[model samples]
Target: MPLTILQKAKKLFDQKKYSQVISLLEPNILQYRESFQFYLYLGLSCLHTGDAGGASSYFQRARQIKMRDPDLLTAQAALFLRRGETDQAVEYYLDALEYDPDHALAKKALQFIRKKGDKETFLNMAETGKITAFYPKPRRTSLHPAAVAAPLAVFILCASIFGIKAVSLSVGQETRADLSSISLQAIDLKNSVEAGGSYRYILTEKQVVQAFENSQRYFQSYRDNQAQVEINRILNSNASIAVRTKARLLMEYLSEPGFDTLKDNFSYATVIQDAYLYQDCWIRWKGMAANVSAPDDRFGFNFLVGYDTRSALEGIVPVSFDKPVFLDPSRPFELLAKIRIENGSLSLLGGGIYQSVSP
Candidate 1:
């Protein structure tokens, strides 16, 4: 009788023979086309063995089957961050947040990434229309021997060309109209306010200018750090080569930062609180901070000052402060908050500290 592969693999695994188990499972993982668990286990095995690249590949395979797992998403983001691919890390972090807005790890990862350096590369691409541009493809040109040999074929070919040309003209007109309509809709939507009143639909041109200004400051700081490192070489014999190398690597990485997708960031925020439920009652409410960043989209209530958590730390709630909403990419947004109970009676949470963005 043949010994079972799974039994042998298990025996190897139980004996702390990870290499043997991996060898046994590797064949099966390749042979079985539909086994997501195999890939998940393979990823774990690789991770245990310190093969980051192999682990990432296996985890990516697992992700194809379980696309929306926040835990896996966070793990992938961590891996990307370790590999010095912060842009990729931020992408996965955003993906993880999309699934679980309250995901603390993902939230922290995003905050950490944002603080590293401004993502100027991504923003510049957006500003230059590179990200959204559709390049014009040239039409193929050819002369067929059949066109000269057959009159009927030539007539048919000419008719087909005219038909295609007519269809192309019609499609071109429709496409232009569609593009124009979409552009107008985008402008309108950008001008609208979110349900949470926490964010405006469109970043004003002024906001874009401010973003560029901040990015320039970040770039200047990055370059200054580089210059200081170069100048210190003469007197810095005590500095380890590895430390200097690592610093140089970091500076290079920060030189070209990426940008968040402005379109995706403008979506309506989830509803966190219902005003009618706590009408005229001073109540302490708790929620995930990411959801509270822009609350105007979900409700029409005005922020009266004592409702904002502007001064609160990331991943922590400030039940005491009542401030208005503010959008700052350099900071972690306390998306979740609630009105505080003060004195005996309920008052409309009012504090002029926070102002809702314009629609």
Candidate 2:
């Protein structure tokens, strides 16, 4: 059944349709969230498509589901290798070998590391996302493919050959069924945070408690953007590690709101009054673009908030967009952005943008 859930993604992966595999699998994540194969392939697709952040996130999610997976270790090693981190790649490959001593890919990768000197050999392996890239693939017998085409046919053949109980036992052993429940368990941080390390108490105990309570309250009301405001405060504050630790965990459950869903949003005018209270909150505001610059993939500009009226420029805040947006220096624009507290002032990371006619 687990294999059945990931069969479509596997087919797409085998066909080397990496981007299409991502498109097909990402949307239906809820259906197969428990399947290790699903996230591994999704992460690989992201890796191949040059989305390192997405790939890293998916791979971490996969690790939470199954820690001792050899293919996942190999893929992570490939990711590190692609980034030219041979030492990290070696560590991951070694970890894979510890799990599967005779694992072909890990063994072969180690051998290449011993005898070979060229970084390109490892780089190519990373580029192809395979330790076996330098080697030729084995040919399978043509007629052997027809023994089982459908899932039912495969199941029947296996059942007839090894009895129904044997089939179940094989599946159970292959997937480490005993550890499946423990796989997704959260990391116990009680001891780590209780010590509180070397942090100074920036906010008073009462203030810290207030922030936490407010965050929890907003979380219950499904106002995630508002909830994050408090979380950011805790993170940026001199709160003890234990309280900040809980704040970080609570943060994991907060989801970003969309345009229609974001409500009761405070504007830049309101945010400037108490920026600390609105840390990491989203705001919708419009202004003129001044001194636009495109360095690398991001667009940066000084946003003239509320300057569309031309009567008064409420404030000038720096903003950058990760997504491609139309940028004209002489234009007024509406920016729906997440506010970041930078250098005791506000900046924005663009979530969405709307362009108006150039003035």
Worst 10 residues of 2 by lDDT: 175-184
Residues 8-34, model 1: lDDT tens digits: 664655465767767878888536434
Evaluate all candidate structures by whole-model CA lDDT and list the values in order.
0.38, 0.64
Alpha-carbon lDDT of model 2: 0.64
Tens digit per residue, CA lDDT, model 2, 184-284:
11232222233334443356666777777787777666677777877877787777667777777786655555454576688777889878767778888
Candidate 1 wrongly placed segments (more than 4 Å) = 1-21, 30-32, 114-359
Off by over 4 Å in 2: 1-207, 236-238, 356-359
For model 1, the local distance difference test gives 0.38
Best by lDDT: 2
Displacement of residue 331 (Cα, Å) in model 2 is 3.5
Candidate 2 to truth, TM: 0.44
